[model samples]
Target: MDLEKPPAQQPPDGCLVVAIRVPVRIVMLVVVLPVRMAWDALVVAGRFLDDAVLRPVGRGLLWFGRAVFVWPFVALWRWVLVPAGRALAWLGHVLVAVPCGWLYRYVLTPIGHAIAWVGRGIAAGLAWVYARVLTPVGHGIMWLLKGLGAVLAAGGVGVAWLVRYLLVVPATWLYEWLLAPVGRALVWCVNGLVWAVRMIVTGIGTALYWTCRILFVLPALALWRWLLVPVGHALAVVGREIGAALGHAWRVAGHISRAVGRFLATLFRWIFVEPVRWAYARVLTPVGHAVRDAVLRPVGEALRAAGRATRQALASARDSARQARADFRRMLFGEPRQPRATVRREPAAADTRTLGSSTTALTKD
Candidate 1:
């Protein structure tokens, strides 16, 4: 009846003991068994799902992930790689730039300078050759030109002298020869003319003396006697006749002068006074009135009438022209034709006949 000692009842028949001696194995078994079973079931289920559906889904997800993340990463790399590479290249260039510049200065610049120097030297050599060697040739050419100019000048001088001698000597000879003959002939003709003039003067003087003696002296002597006898009688008769003729001429001249003067006076009075009176009576007053009445009034009326008529005619003409143009246009191009009606109608009828024939043929076929 000592319950305490009752042989520590043999720990539930299948209970295990572990190292800790506290039925840990049994506790572990009891507790972990269900978890392990559940884990196993889960693992089996996961395996089945993976085989059936999850694997394919995972693969699709992997592909999707690759497409979404890896492709974009690759695309980003492709897109940015050039600039990145350029940056790297620029960095490389920056790193190498100084050396390259130094290399160019030291190596390439020397070569370029050497080539330029060589070219300059060659050009200088050519120029020197041209200046030194060809200078003598140029001098020769100048000398030749000078010699040619001298020869030409000499020839020109010679030709000028020859021309002067030929032309002037010949012309002087011809002029002297021709003028000598002309001078001699003119002198001879002048001498002859003088002789003839002297002869003519002497003959004229002698003949004049003889003619005067015969015509004037002899007649004068003869007439002197005759005149002496008849002088008294002739003087008396001439005196009487002269007196009578003077008296008659004086009377006739006086009468003619009086008549002419009277006629002129009368004509003058008639011309001036009669015309003045006639103009005053017939023309001036009546003309003033007639001008006032007929000319000014009629001109004013005619001007007004002309203005009105012009305006009316212009308006009428404008309207008539508009109407005529309209009518002409209607006749020419409107629906109702005029002179060309038959011409247009013939063609239109022919076209209609042709259309009808075509239509009839089409219907028949």
Candidate 2:
């Protein structure tokens, strides 16, 4: 039912539209072309001026700064300051250090050593005097005391001799002259009495000995020979046989023990001793040598170096102490002088002779 058709729209003419676009293009060219040409020319002029003038001025300023400040400072340090410092160091070594070393080594050290030697000599002389003079004097005094004791002993012997001569001789003579006859008579009576007693005692002892020999010794001897001797001989024979049997058994056991000991010794040697010896010789010895060479040797060297350093330090310290002592002694005593002694002049009387005047005149004539 809604199918009716609508009327078509009429479009504008193409020639009139093209005529309007051509006039607009002509107006734009008149307005924009001159302005674009002026902008392009200004940009080209600016680029030319920057390239020709400004860049060269900046480079000139950089080169001038380098030449005036940096190059001069480097040159002064290299040419003048470094050489002057080296020269000063060399001069100091030549003038100060070398002379000090020479003075210490040559003059100061020898003087110190000489002083030490003189002091040692003085000490030795004192010791010699003590040993030679004082020790011998003490010994001589001891010997003198012993001689005095000997004199006292000799005097005691003389006193004893005097007593014997003065008293004993008189006593003996008095006894011989007065009491000898009486003493002889009394001695004769005592001898007679002692002889009677000894004779009786001998007779009694002889009777007793004979009676015991006949009554007891003969019967005891016969019984021992017949009865006790056979019994003792039979017991001795049985003991000898048993002792021989025990001795034989002991010898057999000893032989077995010695054999077992020898076998054990042989086994120990073969199983343990030889193998241990071989291992020690081949393995342990070589390992020990390797460890010694690689580790112990280096350790020993380090220790030796440390010891040398310590020894040098100790030597320096000792030298310092000695110098200090020497300085102190010098301050106290000013200077030491060598010991001197003067010999006394002997008396002149032994050099002169006295002569009789007449004899001298006769000899001169």
Residue 59 lDDT, candidate 2, scale 0-100: 90
TM-score of each: 0.22, 0.25
Estimate, for each residue in 222-289, the C-alpha lDDT of model 2 and write its tens digit.
99999999989766655554455455444554455556657877999999999999999999999999
Q: Which portions of model 1 show Cα errors greater than 4 Å?
A: 1-272, 275-283, 294-296, 303-311, 330-365
Candidate 2 minimal-lDDT segment of 10 residues? 352-361
The models' CA-based lDDT, in order, is 0.77, 0.81
* Cα lDDT, model 2, residue 317: 100
C-alpha root-mean-square deviation, each candidate: 75.4, 62.4
- Whole-structure CA lDDT of model 2: 0.81
- The TM-score measured for candidate 1 stands at 0.22
What clash count does candidate 1 reach?
A: 0
Please name the candidate that would achieve the greatest TM-score relative to the true structure: 2
Error of 2 at 256 (Å): 1.8
